[model samples]
Target: MKYVIKTQECGYLFKNGILKKILFAGKYRILSMSGWELKITEMTGKVDTKGLPTELLMEQPDFVSRVVRVQIPDDCIGFHLVNGVYKQVIMEGEALYWNVFEKNEIRLVNVTGTEMTEAQVPAMYRHLIPSRLYKRLSVGEGETGLLYIDGRFEKQLSSGTYFYWIYAHEVSMKLYSLKVQQLEISGQEILTSDKVGVRLNILCSYRITRPLELVQKTDNVANLLYTRIQLLAREYIGGFRLDELLAQKEEIGRFLMKQIQGVQEEYCVEILNTGIKDIILPGEIRDIMNTVLVAEKKAQANVIMRREEVASTRSLLNTAKLMEENKVLYRLKELEYLERICDRVGSISLNGAGSVLEQLAALALPKG
Candidate 1:
C-alpha cells in the first residue's frame, strides 16, 4: 500500500520498484543515491514523500519545503541534477579548459553555434579562459577548427600572425574585442636560452599603433621591445666594444634598425620608433679604450706645444737678424753697454776706455 510521508525536510515520492534501503535502520545515516526516478510537483517547493510507496519511507530528504540547493565550492567541479538525482562531475581545471574544448569531442556551453578552424580555436577562446588557462593554450589557425596544443600552440608557426578573441559575453562570434596578431619570422626561430652567457648588444625603434595609454602599466612594452632589439643587434654585432658603437653610432643604429625590421614581419611588435638603447662593453675593453683616448689627447697636446715653441724660436731668430742688419740697432746696443759701465765706474778713464770700447764694439758686431 502507498503511504503519505510528510517531513520538515525535502518531500520526495518514490515508486516501490525503485526504492531500496540505502542505510541501516535505527541510525541517522546520510545516504547518497543515484538513478532514483522522480517528478517535480512544484518547481518552487521542497522535496517530500507524500505519495510514495511504503518501502520508500525508510529515509528522510534534506529539505521538504525549500528550493533545491546546488552550492559548489569550486567551479572546476561541475554539478547537475536530473530526475532528482544529484551528480558531481569534474571538469578541466582552469588551465586546461580552453584546450579541452578545442578537441572535437569536448563541448563547452557557450562555445556552440560558432564555426571555427583548428587554428582559430585557441585565439578565439584564449581571453575567455582564465589567465592560467589562457597561457596554456597554444592556439593556431587550421583547416578543421582552431588547433590547440596543451602548451605550445603548434609547429611551423610563422612570425607576424595574430590571434584575436574577446570575452564570450562581450560580442557574438561575429566580432572580436581583443585582437592579438602574431608576427611570423621568415627564417627559423632562434632560441635565446641556447645562447646564454654570450655577449650581445641590441638597438631598435618602435611605434605604438594604439594609444600608449591603452596598454597596461605593467606591460613594459617599451622595455620588451628594447630587449628584443638588443638581442637582434647582439646577434649581428656581437663582441663589439661599447666605444666602437659610439664611434660608429650611425652605422650601428642603421644596422640594428634593419635587423629589427627583418624580424618585424615575424614578431608583430610595432616599430613606431627605433634607436640604440644601450651598448654593453666588456670592462677590460672599455678601460683599454679610455687609455687609448687619453694617449691620443696627450699626443695632440704635445704637437700643439711643439708648434708654439717652433714659432717662438723663429720669431726670436728673425728679430736678431733684423737687428744685426740695421745701423740704429748697433748704436742702441753701444748706448745700452755705456749706461751699464758708467753706472759701475766712479770716474771717467777715457784714455784706456776708448780702446776697451773699440774691442767691445768689434765683439758686439753681428757675424757675416
Candidate 2:
C-alpha cells in the first residue's frame, strides 16, 4: 500500500509504502518503508490508500496558545480565529477587536466585522445589568436628572442608557427641566383667584445631552426652581396691601417682571416671559385712601391760610415803622385819608381853622 504525508506548515509532501509479510506460519506483520526503497524491491504495481499522511493527522494547536498581546478598538463587532473558528461576539455596536500571536510560534490570525461611521458612535458607554433597580425619568428642555453611580453623582451624559451598581436601597431622584417660561399677564388671559388676579403662563422644555443616572440628587434642581417661583410670587405680589394692582398697574408690572428675571438668573433658566393680568384691590381700602387724600388737602389749605395771615401782619408792622421814622410821611398819610373820606361823604364839616387845628392835634396824639 502506498501513502502520502503532507506537512501543514511547509506543505511538504512525502510518499511511502506499507508492506505486509508472513513471518513464520499463521503470523502476519505490516511494515512502513520508504517508497523509493520499496520500488527497488521489484513491486509489481503501485498500491494507493486514500488517507491523510501521518504527520498531517496531528491536532492543530489552539489559536490563543501563542497570543502575546491584543488591542481592540472601542466599537468592534466580533472576533474569530485564523483556522475559521469564531471566538468572541460583541453584543454592543461600535466596538473593535484584535488578536496578537507570538512570532513564529503560532500563525497570527485576525477576524473582524463590518465597520460603522464616526457619527454613529456613542459619546459614552452605559452598562445595564439584569435584576437591578433603575430609575426611569423623563427630561424636558433645559432640565436634567441626577444619577448616583455607587455613591457619587455624575454631572452630565449624552443622550443614552446608563446603569448603576445595585445597592441594598435603590437611589431616588426628582425629574425637572431648566428652561423657564415667563407668565403672560394680559387682561384676556388673567388667572383669577379669590383674593388676587394674575396674568401669566409658564411653559418649560428641555433636551438630554448625556447618559444620566437618576437619583435623589436630580430632584434638587427642579425643587429649587418651583420653590423660588412660589416664594417670589408670594413675597412680591402677596405682600402688596393694595387690593387693586391696577391702581399702580404699571409699577407693579415692572416690579414683577424684574423679580421673575432675577429668579430665572438664579436658577440658570431662560426666562420666556413675565406678565401681569389684572390689578385687584379691596373696596374698603380704596375708600380709605380717598378719605386720607381729602384730609391731607384740608391740612394743606390750613397751612396756606396761616401763611397769608403772617404776611399781612408783617406788612402792617413795616408800614407803621416807616411812618414813625418820618413825621412828614405821617402828615401826608393823614391828608390822603381825609381826602378819600371827603370824596365819599358829600361834604366835610369843621369849625373853621380852630376845628382844623383840633383835628390835626387829635391825629398827632398817640391813642391810648
Per-model CA lDDT versus the true structure: 0.41, 0.41
What TM-score goes with each of the models? 0.33, 0.30
Model 2 per-residue lDDT tens digits across residues 100-216: 221211111111211112232221322211233223334455556555444565444333444332323344434444333333322232333345434433222222222242232
Off by over 4 Å in 1: 1-205, 210-227, 239-246, 262-272, 329-368
Q: What is the lDDT of residue 338 in candidate 1?
A: 85
- What lDDT score is found at residue 49 in candidate 1? 40
Task: For candidate 2, give the lDDT of residue 224.
Answer: 55
lDDT per residue for candidate 1 within 1-368, as digits (tens), equals 22222222222433443544322112132223534433323222222344663233434332211223222333232223234233223234321111111211223323322223344343434334444222232323321122223332233222223332222212111111123333222222222323312233333435333322323232445455556664665565444544454667667667766666665434434554354444444577578878999999999999999999999999999878977998788678777878897797676545554555686566567989
